[model samples]
Target: MNTGRVVLITGTSSGIGLAAAVQAAQAGYTVVATMRDTTRSDALLKAAAEAGVTVDVRRLDVTDPESVAACVTAVADSYGRLDALVNNAGRANTFATIETCDLATYREVIEVNFLGVVAVTRAGLPHLRAAGGRIVTVGSTRGLIGQPFNEGYSAAKFAVEGFMESLAPTAAGMGVRVVMVEPGPVFETAFGANSGLTRESLLTEAGPYRRVLEPYLDWVARGAHPGAQTGREIAEHIVTALTDPEPPFRVLTSDWAREYTAIKYTDPEGGRVRAMTASWLAREED
Candidate 1:
């Protein structure tokens, strides 16, 4: 039990972040569970209570620099050290082609998904360095292989992937480990609902892209595939990455995720990935 070890997690109002907070506390780490609004923290608190674990719930808006800095500072001041940081706060983009997406929409996704990670990590690095800590990010398979209509989200996650991959070796040299946990389709999460996209809405907005969007939506509604996981399942992977003696740089949540991402690793030329994703948007007659 890591009684004195402290870990800060963002976006704990629901889903993966909430699960991670509860599990981390159960693992005996002092968990600081944060969300944009403290008013939304009932779920996290209740879960922690039910599990007979205590979590220090705080308000942290990752997109705001002041909020990020203040939260990290407070945690360090109160705990004297930070052992780990989980970059889990993210916003999903609506299902739309790049051409159809407005610039503001793209910016919103980037702000919360990519830059939010940057701000929090930057603020926590000093304390983390002192503790020789770790940073675990919740990434998606979309970051490895872009989807047809999720350009904004995929782009943001891809930026995160590049930034973390480049920072890993240098961080390791500093006695800090950085890991990315990649999950495929996650079930029982607010992630999909937060996107604010529905079948009718997407079809109405598809306009010129309807021909392609239809098949894409059809493929999505076909129900869960082997690669789909629950919030708890992904959270388990996050906790394992945090606790493992020598975790890999990239941790895929399930066997299906490993196989799915293996396509990208093997296809350096990008042909196989393109073919596979394209099949999801294929026309009925094709």
Candidate 2:
């Protein structure tokens, strides 16, 4: 968790991945920054150089299982061990309705966000167990509650959280840890633009789903933006988790995130959530 620790991070080209890698390097971790194309990671490389740390930049498309396996193998071979794996590579889908959106759109989102973590974590397990390290997966507040226009993205994150909740207990037994970093909408990143590549029709004419679409995007734009923590601020939180005397199982980014998690747990089940989102099912009401 500190400097000299060997950490591997996915999607280091921009946004949270970029910020986290820089901060982790500054914290003294020998960072391995992976992207779809390392040749284009010029900015991230420059940032690390400026910070006086050398990051092992490599090309790793997480969606490709072969790439994931190879990169992780390279990590183990070069470092002899890995202390942490940060699965911060993900994209959002801002469609008007699931009906109109093609299956390809949903697949694209899930492949990169959900399955990518599974692939990478599975590959990194042996090295991590040998080092008794940690796994940090980036999640969203959207994973907690169904937002309006971004169902696909939310679903993907929801799946990730579910997977980690199960994986954490097993990891703890082995002296390894699994932690989820849940952040609210932070304006510092370029998620929307990159998401546009996979999911289009987000800001189009209000469809039948206009009610859900407008309010959610507005809330995301206005409410979340003003209180959006700096990329550096979020980075520091990770540093705390890595070095804490007793790090939390999950680190929530905002007061709202904490309150919402409290509500979900305090309710015995997600009763409040299902009741509010009437269309959603109360399949696991406790």
Candidate 3:
């Protein structure tokens, strides 16, 4: 139990944000779980009830500046201090290549993922500075690589990574720490369901696949199940990031992803496969 620690998480209607809120409340934190609408958060309310933990459900639309500011004000005014903030309200836009993407989709993605983060972080900076707390932004491995299909999602995440890196020094000066959790594919969640993909780019009037690729859609649908990390695991990690003396600035949740990153780090892009090919020779040298 976290002994009534005060925290806030955006996008609490479902997926990672919902789970994180439940877990935090269970851990004895007084959580302010903000969805776009509180009246519609039946699942969250029911789950919280079952767990016997009380979490305040508020309304927050990250894309709207007024909504973002209001949520921050509500938290600070009501709680008098905020211990931590988990900016988990985000989306992934698949099948949107740069050459063919709708400008509207790109704007929506950047507004919510990049600008929304800035709005909320700036609003909370005062209280976070007072509490000397931590900030956790859910990033993606795609943020590191240039995946062709997820251009919009990748670009937004890349911007987030850059923004976080730039703010790290200033945040540290205020005794506020920032961490980015880079997770690989997860098993279950509303992510795929809520993923704002459309036929604009994937099914253009002209091009290779004049129709959207059904097979690719099928693969993505099956891959993003929520069981990969239960609502509890994310909560535990969030707690660790808040309290751990030497919390990782970047935590990659997948084992293979870690191994892959390690390989990429040790050997240049073209050198990893060859390095892995001769394990015995490397071992002999060691």
lDDT of each: 0.93, 0.78, 0.74
Per-residue CA lDDT of candidate 2, range 57-110, in tens? Answer: 998998998999999999889988899998988866645468757788788888
Models 1 onward score TM values of 0.98, 0.87, 0.83
Single out the weakest 10-residue window by summed lDDT for candidate 3.
276-285
Per-residue CA lDDT of model 1 for 1-286, tens digit only, reads 6579999999999999999999999998999999998998898889888999899999899999999999999999999999999999999767898888788999999999999999999998898899999999998998998998999999999999999999999899999999999999999999789777789998998899999999988988887366899999999999999999899999998899989889999999999999989998997789
Q: Candidate 2: lDDT of 77?
A: 91
User: Where does candidate 2 stray beyond 4 Å?
Assistant: 1-3, 197-206, 224-226, 268-286
Count of clashing residue pairs in every prediction: 0, 2, 6
* Candidate 1's TM-score: 0.98
TM-score between candidate 3 and the true structure: 0.83
Clashing pairs in 1: none
The list of candidate 1 runs beyond 4 A from truth reads none
State the lDDT at 120 in candidate 2: 94
Candidate 3, residue 262: Cα displacement in angstroms equals 3.4
Model 1 collision count: 0
Q: Which candidate is the best by lDDT?
A: 1
